[model samples]
Target: MVKWDEDIYNTPAYPVTDAARYLGIPVVTLRSWLKSRPSADNNDQPALEPLIQRPDPNLPQLSFTNLVEAHVLRIIRATHGVKLDKVRKALDYMSQQFDTAHPLVMKRFQTDGVDLFVDQMDRLVNVSRSGQLAMRETLKHLLTRVEWDEEGIATRFFPLIESVPESEKVIFLDPAIRFGKPVIAGTGIPTASIVSLIDAGDEIEDVADEFDCTPAQVRAAIQFEAQNRAA
Candidate 1:
Protein backbone atom coordinates (compact mmCIF):
# COMPACT_ATOMS: atom_id res chain seq x y z
CA MET A 1 0.00 0.00 0.00
CA VAL A 2 1.25 3.48 -0.79
CA LYS A 3 1.19 5.43 2.47
CA TRP A 4 -0.59 8.63 1.48
CA ASP A 5 -0.94 11.38 4.06
CA GLU A 6 -4.48 10.86 5.27
CA ASP A 7 -5.16 14.51 6.08
CA ILE A 8 -3.77 15.88 2.87
CA TYR A 9 -3.87 14.26 -0.55
CA ASN A 10 -5.92 11.23 0.46
CA THR A 11 -8.83 13.15 1.95
CA PRO A 12 -11.87 13.63 -0.30
CA ALA A 13 -11.33 17.26 -1.31
CA TYR A 14 -12.94 17.64 -4.73
CA PRO A 15 -16.48 16.86 -5.75
CA VAL A 16 -17.01 14.88 -8.99
CA THR A 17 -17.77 18.02 -11.01
CA ASP A 18 -14.79 19.90 -9.62
CA ALA A 19 -12.41 17.02 -10.33
CA ALA A 20 -13.65 16.74 -13.91
CA ARG A 21 -13.23 20.47 -14.45
CA TYR A 22 -9.69 20.41 -13.13
CA LEU A 23 -8.83 17.42 -15.33
CA GLY A 24 -10.48 18.85 -18.46
CA ILE A 25 -12.65 15.73 -18.73
CA PRO A 26 -16.38 15.66 -19.32
CA VAL A 27 -18.38 15.44 -16.09
CA VAL A 28 -20.47 12.53 -17.38
CA THR A 29 -17.38 10.67 -18.54
CA LEU A 30 -15.72 11.15 -15.16
CA ARG A 31 -18.84 10.00 -13.35
CA SER A 32 -18.85 6.83 -15.44
CA TRP A 33 -15.21 6.26 -14.56
CA LEU A 34 -15.94 6.78 -10.87
CA LYS A 35 -19.22 4.86 -10.57
CA SER A 36 -19.74 1.49 -12.20
CA ARG A 37 -22.78 1.25 -14.45
CA PRO A 38 -24.34 -1.46 -16.60
CA SER A 39 -23.34 -1.52 -20.24
CA ALA A 40 -25.70 0.35 -22.57
CA ASP A 41 -25.88 -2.61 -24.92
CA ASN A 42 -26.52 -5.35 -22.33
CA ASN A 43 -27.74 -4.85 -18.78
CA ASP A 44 -27.23 -8.60 -18.20
CA GLN A 45 -23.49 -8.19 -18.54
CA PRO A 46 -21.35 -7.35 -15.51
CA ALA A 47 -21.12 -3.67 -14.73
CA LEU A 48 -17.87 -2.04 -15.72
CA GLU A 49 -15.51 -1.45 -12.81
CA PRO A 50 -14.48 2.09 -11.89
CA LEU A 51 -11.01 3.02 -13.04
CA ILE A 52 -10.12 4.92 -9.82
CA GLN A 53 -11.53 4.28 -6.36
CA ARG A 54 -12.63 7.36 -4.42
CA PRO A 55 -11.12 7.99 -0.99
CA ASP A 56 -14.51 7.64 0.64
CA PRO A 57 -16.72 5.17 -1.19
CA ASN A 58 -19.73 6.66 0.56
CA LEU A 59 -19.12 10.07 -1.02
CA PRO A 60 -19.10 11.26 -4.60
CA GLN A 61 -15.81 13.09 -4.18
CA LEU A 62 -12.24 12.46 -5.20
CA SER A 63 -8.94 12.91 -3.43
CA PHE A 64 -6.03 14.65 -5.09
CA THR A 65 -4.58 11.26 -5.94
CA ASN A 66 -7.79 10.31 -7.71
CA LEU A 67 -7.51 13.47 -9.75
CA VAL A 68 -4.04 12.42 -10.84
CA GLU A 69 -5.28 9.01 -11.88
CA ALA A 70 -8.10 10.59 -13.88
CA HIS A 71 -5.63 12.92 -15.55
CA VAL A 72 -3.53 9.97 -16.68
CA LEU A 73 -6.60 8.06 -17.79
CA ARG A 74 -7.65 11.06 -19.90
CA ILE A 75 -4.30 10.93 -21.71
CA ILE A 76 -4.52 7.18 -22.29
CA ARG A 77 -8.17 6.53 -23.09
CA ALA A 78 -9.06 9.92 -24.57
CA THR A 79 -5.92 11.32 -26.16
CA HIS A 80 -4.41 8.02 -27.32
CA GLY A 81 -7.82 6.46 -28.12
CA VAL A 82 -7.05 3.36 -26.06
CA LYS A 83 -10.05 1.17 -25.25
CA LEU A 84 -11.41 1.17 -21.71
CA ASP A 85 -11.22 -2.62 -21.28
CA LYS A 86 -7.56 -2.70 -22.25
CA VAL A 87 -6.80 0.12 -19.80
CA ARG A 88 -8.55 -1.70 -16.97
CA LYS A 89 -6.59 -4.88 -17.70
CA ALA A 90 -3.30 -3.05 -17.87
CA LEU A 91 -4.03 -1.27 -14.56
CA ASP A 92 -5.05 -4.57 -12.94
CA TYR A 93 -1.83 -6.21 -14.10
CA MET A 94 0.23 -3.28 -12.81
CA SER A 95 -1.59 -3.30 -9.47
CA GLN A 96 -0.80 -7.00 -8.93
CA GLN A 97 2.82 -6.64 -10.06
CA PHE A 98 3.60 -3.40 -8.22
CA ASP A 99 1.57 -4.16 -5.08
CA THR A 100 0.01 -0.70 -5.20
CA ALA A 101 -3.57 0.29 -5.91
CA HIS A 102 -2.54 3.49 -7.72
CA PRO A 103 0.20 2.40 -10.10
CA LEU A 104 0.03 5.28 -12.58
CA VAL A 105 0.89 7.94 -9.98
CA MET A 106 3.79 6.00 -8.52
CA LYS A 107 7.29 7.28 -9.25
CA ARG A 108 8.57 3.97 -10.52
CA PHE A 109 5.89 3.96 -13.24
CA GLN A 110 8.07 6.16 -15.45
CA THR A 111 11.02 3.82 -15.16
CA ASP A 112 9.29 0.40 -15.23
CA GLY A 113 5.50 0.45 -15.58
CA VAL A 114 5.30 2.27 -18.93
CA ASP A 115 6.98 -0.53 -20.85
CA LEU A 116 4.96 -3.19 -19.05
CA PHE A 117 1.72 -1.34 -19.73
CA VAL A 118 2.58 -0.88 -23.41
CA ASP A 119 3.48 -4.56 -23.74
CA GLN A 120 0.22 -5.59 -22.11
CA MET A 121 -1.75 -3.31 -24.42
CA ASP A 122 0.05 -4.77 -27.43
CA ARG A 123 -0.94 -8.29 -26.39
CA LEU A 124 -4.52 -7.35 -25.55
CA VAL A 125 -5.16 -5.16 -28.61
CA ASN A 126 -2.58 -6.51 -31.08
CA VAL A 127 -1.19 -3.01 -31.66
CA SER A 128 1.65 -2.93 -34.17
CA ARG A 129 5.23 -2.78 -32.92
CA SER A 130 5.44 0.87 -33.95
CA GLY A 131 2.17 1.54 -32.18
CA GLN A 132 3.59 -0.05 -29.05
CA LEU A 133 6.62 2.23 -29.23
CA ALA A 134 4.40 5.26 -29.73
CA MET A 135 2.24 4.31 -26.77
CA ARG A 136 5.31 3.84 -24.60
CA GLU A 137 6.68 7.24 -25.58
CA THR A 138 3.33 8.92 -25.03
CA LEU A 139 2.91 7.38 -21.59
CA LYS A 140 6.44 8.34 -20.63
CA HIS A 141 5.72 11.90 -21.66
CA LEU A 142 2.50 12.00 -19.65
CA LEU A 143 4.33 10.76 -16.55
CA THR A 144 6.64 13.73 -16.77
CA ARG A 145 3.88 16.04 -15.48
CA VAL A 146 3.61 14.14 -12.19
CA GLU A 147 6.00 14.81 -9.32
CA TRP A 148 6.40 12.11 -6.69
CA ASP A 149 7.70 12.14 -3.16
CA GLU A 150 10.32 9.92 -1.46
CA GLU A 151 7.74 7.18 -0.87
CA GLY A 152 7.04 7.02 -4.64
CA ILE A 153 3.58 8.60 -4.30
CA ALA A 154 2.57 11.59 -6.37
CA THR A 155 2.93 14.91 -4.52
CA ARG A 156 2.28 17.49 -7.23
CA PHE A 157 0.85 17.66 -10.74
CA PHE A 158 1.66 20.15 -13.51
CA PRO A 159 -1.42 20.50 -15.64
CA LEU A 160 -1.11 21.74 -19.18
CA ILE A 161 -2.53 25.27 -19.35
CA GLU A 162 -1.81 25.51 -23.06
CA SER A 163 -0.15 23.59 -25.87
CA VAL A 164 3.27 24.28 -24.45
CA PRO A 165 6.35 22.14 -23.93
CA GLU A 166 6.22 19.43 -21.27
CA SER A 167 9.17 20.94 -19.43
CA GLU A 168 7.35 24.26 -18.99
CA LYS A 169 5.84 24.12 -15.52
CA VAL A 170 3.75 27.32 -15.48
CA ILE A 171 0.90 26.03 -13.34
CA PHE A 172 0.70 23.19 -10.83
CA LEU A 173 -1.64 21.47 -8.38
CA ASP A 174 -0.19 20.58 -5.00
CA PRO A 175 -2.22 19.04 -2.19
CA ALA A 176 -0.29 21.12 0.30
CA ILE A 177 -1.29 24.39 -1.39
CA ARG A 178 -4.69 26.05 -1.86
CA PHE A 179 -6.54 22.82 -1.05
CA GLY A 180 -5.02 21.24 -4.18
CA LYS A 181 -6.24 23.98 -6.54
CA PRO A 182 -4.07 24.80 -9.55
CA VAL A 183 -1.68 27.70 -8.88
CA ILE A 184 1.01 29.65 -10.63
CA ALA A 185 3.92 27.17 -10.60
CA GLY A 186 6.26 28.61 -7.93
CA THR A 187 4.33 31.57 -6.50
CA GLY A 188 1.49 29.80 -4.69
CA ILE A 189 -0.97 32.25 -6.29
CA PRO A 190 -4.14 30.52 -7.37
CA THR A 191 -4.73 30.71 -11.10
CA ALA A 192 -8.41 31.37 -10.57
CA SER A 193 -7.62 34.30 -8.29
CA ILE A 194 -5.48 35.81 -10.98
CA VAL A 195 -8.24 35.37 -13.51
CA SER A 196 -10.69 36.91 -11.08
CA LEU A 197 -8.59 40.03 -10.95
CA ILE A 198 -8.72 40.20 -14.72
CA ASP A 199 -12.48 39.73 -14.67
CA ALA A 200 -12.70 42.60 -12.17
CA GLY A 201 -11.09 44.87 -14.80
CA ASP A 202 -7.59 44.80 -13.36
CA GLU A 203 -4.85 45.03 -15.96
CA ILE A 204 -2.83 41.86 -16.52
CA GLU A 205 0.45 43.59 -15.77
CA ASP A 206 -1.06 45.16 -12.65
CA VAL A 207 -2.26 41.76 -11.45
CA ALA A 208 1.17 40.30 -12.11
CA ASP A 209 2.83 43.10 -10.21
CA GLU A 210 0.33 42.73 -7.36
CA PHE A 211 1.12 39.04 -7.16
CA ASP A 212 4.83 39.67 -7.74
CA CYS A 213 4.62 37.36 -10.76
CA THR A 214 5.52 38.09 -14.35
CA PRO A 215 3.00 39.20 -17.00
CA ALA A 216 3.62 35.86 -18.67
CA GLN A 217 2.53 34.11 -15.49
CA VAL A 218 -0.65 36.20 -15.41
CA ARG A 219 -1.32 35.25 -19.03
CA ALA A 220 -0.83 31.60 -18.08
CA ALA A 221 -3.40 31.98 -15.34
CA ILE A 222 -5.86 33.42 -17.87
CA GLN A 223 -5.16 30.55 -20.26
CA PHE A 224 -5.63 27.95 -17.52
CA GLU A 225 -8.95 29.44 -16.42
CA ALA A 226 -10.11 29.79 -20.05
CA GLN A 227 -9.34 26.14 -20.72
CA ASN A 228 -11.20 25.06 -17.60
CA ARG A 229 -14.19 27.19 -18.54
CA ALA A 230 -14.18 25.91 -22.10
CA ALA A 231 -14.04 22.34 -20.82
Candidate 2:
Protein backbone atom coordinates (compact mmCIF):
# COMPACT_ATOMS: atom_id res chain seq x y z
CA MET A 1 0.00 0.00 0.00
CA VAL A 2 2.94 2.29 -0.45
CA LYS A 3 1.89 5.22 -2.62
CA TRP A 4 4.54 6.48 -5.06
CA ASP A 5 5.54 10.06 -5.85
CA GLU A 6 4.04 12.26 -8.60
CA ASP A 7 7.32 13.95 -9.53
CA ILE A 8 10.31 12.38 -11.21
CA TYR A 9 8.22 10.09 -13.39
CA ASN A 10 10.84 9.19 -16.05
CA THR A 11 14.08 10.52 -14.65
CA PRO A 12 16.87 8.03 -14.16
CA ALA A 13 16.76 8.19 -10.37
CA TYR A 14 17.40 4.45 -10.44
CA PRO A 15 19.76 2.64 -12.80
CA VAL A 16 18.46 2.25 -16.37
CA THR A 17 18.96 -1.50 -16.17
CA ASP A 18 16.69 -1.64 -13.11
CA ALA A 19 14.19 0.63 -14.79
CA ALA A 20 14.17 -1.64 -17.85
CA ARG A 21 13.47 -4.59 -15.55
CA TYR A 22 10.51 -2.75 -14.02
CA LEU A 23 9.25 -1.81 -17.48
CA GLY A 24 10.01 -5.30 -18.83
CA ILE A 25 12.07 -3.86 -21.70
CA PRO A 26 15.69 -4.27 -22.66
CA VAL A 27 18.17 -1.69 -21.40
CA VAL A 28 19.45 -1.22 -24.94
CA THR A 29 15.99 -0.17 -26.13
CA LEU A 30 15.53 2.31 -23.32
CA ARG A 31 18.95 3.76 -23.90
CA SER A 32 18.30 4.05 -27.62
CA TRP A 33 15.19 6.15 -27.03
CA LEU A 34 16.88 8.32 -24.43
CA LYS A 35 19.61 9.48 -26.75
CA SER A 36 17.23 10.58 -29.51
CA ARG A 37 16.12 14.24 -29.69
CA PRO A 38 12.53 15.46 -29.79
CA SER A 39 11.01 17.08 -32.91
CA ALA A 40 11.14 20.86 -32.92
CA ASP A 41 7.85 22.61 -32.11
CA ASN A 42 6.65 25.90 -33.66
CA ASN A 43 7.03 27.59 -30.27
CA ASP A 44 10.53 26.20 -29.87
CA GLN A 45 10.24 24.13 -26.65
CA PRO A 46 13.47 22.55 -25.43
CA ALA A 47 13.97 18.89 -26.41
CA LEU A 48 13.44 16.00 -23.97
CA GLU A 49 16.06 15.62 -21.26
CA PRO A 50 18.60 12.89 -21.86
CA LEU A 51 19.44 10.23 -19.26
CA ILE A 52 22.90 11.39 -18.24
CA GLN A 53 24.87 8.18 -18.15
CA ARG A 54 28.65 7.96 -18.52
CA PRO A 55 28.64 8.94 -22.20
CA ASP A 56 28.39 5.85 -24.36
CA PRO A 57 28.96 5.98 -28.14
CA ASN A 58 25.93 3.81 -28.97
CA LEU A 59 23.32 6.25 -27.57
CA PRO A 60 20.88 7.60 -30.18
CA GLN A 61 19.43 11.10 -30.11
CA LEU A 62 15.65 10.54 -29.61
CA SER A 63 12.59 11.82 -27.77
CA PHE A 64 12.26 10.35 -24.23
CA THR A 65 8.58 11.21 -23.57
CA ASN A 66 7.47 8.78 -26.26
CA LEU A 67 9.06 5.88 -24.41
CA VAL A 68 7.68 6.96 -21.04
CA GLU A 69 4.14 7.51 -22.33
CA ALA A 70 4.16 4.12 -24.01
CA HIS A 71 4.99 2.42 -20.73
CA VAL A 72 2.33 4.46 -18.87
CA LEU A 73 -0.52 3.54 -21.23
CA ARG A 74 0.59 -0.08 -21.35
CA ILE A 75 0.63 -0.41 -17.54
CA ILE A 76 -2.70 1.41 -17.17
CA ARG A 77 -4.54 -0.73 -19.70
CA ALA A 78 -3.12 -3.97 -18.30
CA THR A 79 -4.12 -3.27 -14.69
CA HIS A 80 -7.75 -2.54 -15.67
CA GLY A 81 -9.32 0.42 -13.90
CA VAL A 82 -5.86 1.59 -13.06
CA LYS A 83 -6.80 4.83 -11.37
CA LEU A 84 -5.59 7.96 -13.10
CA ASP A 85 -4.12 8.69 -9.71
CA LYS A 86 -2.25 5.38 -9.66
CA VAL A 87 -1.02 5.76 -13.24
CA ARG A 88 0.13 9.23 -12.40
CA LYS A 89 1.84 7.89 -9.30
CA ALA A 90 3.64 5.19 -11.25
CA LEU A 91 4.63 7.75 -13.88
CA ASP A 92 6.02 10.14 -11.29
CA TYR A 93 8.16 7.39 -9.82
CA MET A 94 9.38 6.12 -13.17
CA SER A 95 9.97 9.40 -15.02
CA GLN A 96 10.93 11.75 -12.18
CA GLN A 97 8.85 14.48 -13.84
CA PHE A 98 7.31 16.64 -11.09
CA ASP A 99 4.90 18.36 -13.47
CA THR A 100 1.80 16.18 -13.65
CA ALA A 101 0.70 17.53 -17.02
CA HIS A 102 3.50 17.41 -19.55
CA PRO A 103 2.94 18.87 -23.03
CA LEU A 104 4.50 15.91 -24.87
CA VAL A 105 2.28 13.92 -27.22
CA MET A 106 2.66 10.38 -28.62
CA LYS A 107 2.47 10.08 -32.42
CA ARG A 108 2.03 6.33 -32.82
CA PHE A 109 1.56 3.13 -30.78
CA GLN A 110 2.34 -0.56 -31.18
CA THR A 111 -0.58 -2.78 -30.17
CA ASP A 112 1.49 -5.97 -30.07
CA GLY A 113 4.04 -4.35 -27.83
CA VAL A 114 1.22 -3.25 -25.55
CA ASP A 115 0.00 -6.84 -25.26
CA LEU A 116 3.49 -8.06 -24.45
CA PHE A 117 3.72 -5.30 -21.88
CA VAL A 118 0.48 -6.51 -20.30
CA ASP A 119 1.79 -10.06 -20.04
CA GLN A 120 4.73 -8.90 -17.95
CA MET A 121 2.57 -6.56 -15.92
CA ASP A 122 0.21 -9.43 -15.14
CA ARG A 123 3.19 -11.46 -13.95
CA LEU A 124 3.86 -8.66 -11.48
CA VAL A 125 0.37 -7.54 -10.36
CA ASN A 126 -2.08 -10.40 -10.97
CA VAL A 127 -1.34 -12.32 -7.76
CA SER A 128 -1.68 -9.38 -5.41
CA ARG A 129 -4.83 -7.87 -6.91
CA SER A 130 -6.79 -10.61 -8.64
CA GLY A 131 -5.46 -13.94 -7.51
CA GLN A 132 -8.79 -15.66 -8.00
CA LEU A 133 -9.08 -14.76 -11.65
CA ALA A 134 -5.57 -15.90 -12.52
CA MET A 135 -5.82 -19.18 -14.49
CA ARG A 136 -4.44 -22.18 -12.59
CA GLU A 137 -3.65 -23.92 -15.85
CA THR A 138 -1.56 -20.99 -16.87
CA LEU A 139 0.28 -21.17 -13.57
CA LYS A 140 0.91 -24.89 -13.99
CA HIS A 141 2.10 -24.33 -17.52
CA LEU A 142 4.58 -21.68 -16.40
CA LEU A 143 5.84 -23.75 -13.48
CA THR A 144 6.41 -26.69 -15.78
CA ARG A 145 8.28 -24.55 -18.29
CA VAL A 146 10.40 -22.59 -15.83
CA GLU A 147 14.12 -23.04 -16.40
CA TRP A 148 16.34 -23.11 -13.32
CA ASP A 149 19.41 -20.96 -13.81
CA GLU A 150 21.74 -23.09 -11.68
CA GLU A 151 21.56 -26.58 -13.18
CA GLY A 152 19.56 -25.91 -16.34
CA ILE A 153 17.14 -28.52 -15.01
CA ALA A 154 13.41 -28.39 -15.62
CA THR A 155 12.07 -29.86 -12.38
CA ARG A 156 8.43 -30.15 -11.40
CA PHE A 157 6.75 -26.91 -10.50
CA PHE A 158 5.45 -26.32 -6.96
CA PRO A 159 3.55 -23.43 -5.41
CA LEU A 160 6.25 -23.12 -2.80
CA ILE A 161 5.59 -19.45 -2.33
CA GLU A 162 2.03 -20.26 -1.31
CA SER A 163 2.37 -23.75 0.08
CA VAL A 164 0.87 -24.88 3.38
CA PRO A 165 3.19 -26.42 5.97
CA GLU A 166 2.39 -29.88 7.41
CA SER A 167 1.76 -28.46 10.85
CA GLU A 168 -0.84 -26.16 9.34
CA LYS A 169 -1.82 -28.53 6.56
CA VAL A 170 -4.35 -30.23 8.84
CA ILE A 171 -6.04 -26.90 9.42
CA PHE A 172 -6.61 -26.59 5.67
CA LEU A 173 -8.22 -30.04 5.71
CA ASP A 174 -10.90 -29.08 8.22
CA PRO A 175 -14.42 -29.39 6.80
CA ALA A 176 -15.50 -26.13 8.36
CA ILE A 177 -12.62 -24.24 6.76
CA ARG A 178 -12.75 -22.55 3.33
CA PHE A 179 -16.08 -24.10 2.35
CA GLY A 180 -15.13 -27.47 3.94
CA LYS A 181 -11.84 -28.20 2.06
CA PRO A 182 -9.54 -25.48 0.92
CA VAL A 183 -6.21 -26.92 2.31
CA ILE A 184 -5.33 -23.46 3.45
CA ALA A 185 -2.63 -24.51 5.91
CA GLY A 186 -4.39 -22.37 8.51
CA THR A 187 -7.56 -21.63 6.64
CA GLY A 188 -10.20 -23.83 4.95
CA ILE A 189 -9.90 -26.10 1.86
CA PRO A 190 -7.94 -29.35 1.59
CA THR A 191 -5.10 -29.37 -0.90
CA ALA A 192 -5.95 -32.99 -1.70
CA SER A 193 -9.52 -32.09 -2.55
CA ILE A 194 -8.31 -29.89 -5.35
CA VAL A 195 -5.86 -32.54 -6.53
CA SER A 196 -8.59 -35.17 -6.38
CA LEU A 197 -10.60 -33.11 -8.79
CA ILE A 198 -7.62 -33.30 -11.11
CA ASP A 199 -7.40 -37.09 -10.65
CA ALA A 200 -11.11 -37.49 -11.35
CA GLY A 201 -10.65 -36.92 -15.08
CA ASP A 202 -10.83 -33.17 -14.70
CA GLU A 203 -7.86 -31.48 -16.32
CA ILE A 204 -5.52 -29.65 -13.94
CA GLU A 205 -6.71 -26.58 -15.82
CA ASP A 206 -10.29 -27.54 -15.19
CA VAL A 207 -9.58 -28.34 -11.56
CA ALA A 208 -8.05 -24.94 -10.99
CA ASP A 209 -10.71 -23.38 -13.20
CA GLU A 210 -13.24 -23.91 -10.41
CA PHE A 211 -10.87 -23.78 -7.47
CA ASP A 212 -9.07 -20.76 -5.99
CA CYS A 213 -5.58 -21.87 -6.95
CA THR A 214 -3.14 -22.10 -9.85
CA PRO A 215 -2.65 -25.41 -11.71
CA ALA A 216 0.82 -25.47 -10.21
CA GLN A 217 -0.74 -25.59 -6.75
CA VAL A 218 -3.07 -28.37 -7.81
CA ARG A 219 -0.02 -30.33 -8.96
CA ALA A 220 1.77 -29.55 -5.72
CA ALA A 221 -0.96 -31.41 -3.84
CA ILE A 222 -0.59 -34.39 -6.16
CA GLN A 223 3.17 -34.40 -5.72
CA PHE A 224 2.72 -34.12 -1.99
CA GLU A 225 0.44 -37.14 -2.10
CA ALA A 226 2.94 -39.11 -4.20
CA GLN A 227 5.70 -38.47 -1.67
CA ASN A 228 3.47 -39.58 1.19
CA ARG A 229 2.55 -42.72 -0.72
CA ALA A 230 6.19 -43.55 -1.36
CA ALA A 231 7.11 -43.04 2.31
Each candidate: what lDDT? Answer: 0.86, 0.38
Candidate 1: residue pairs that collide: none
Residue 185 in model 2: lDDT = 44
Q: Give the Cα error of residue 125 in candidate 2, in Å.
A: 51
- Candidate 1 accuracy as lDDT: 0.86
Model 1 bad stretches (over 4 Å)? 1-7, 37-48
**Model 2 regions more than 4 Å off:** 1-182, 185-187
Best by the TM-score measure: 1
> Which RMSD values do the candidates have, in order?
2.5, 18.6
| TM agreement with the true structure for every prediction | 0.91, 0.23
TM-score of 2: 0.23
**Distance from true position, residue 81, model 1, in Å?**
1.8
Compute the lDDT of residue 219 as modeled in candidate 1.
Answer: 91
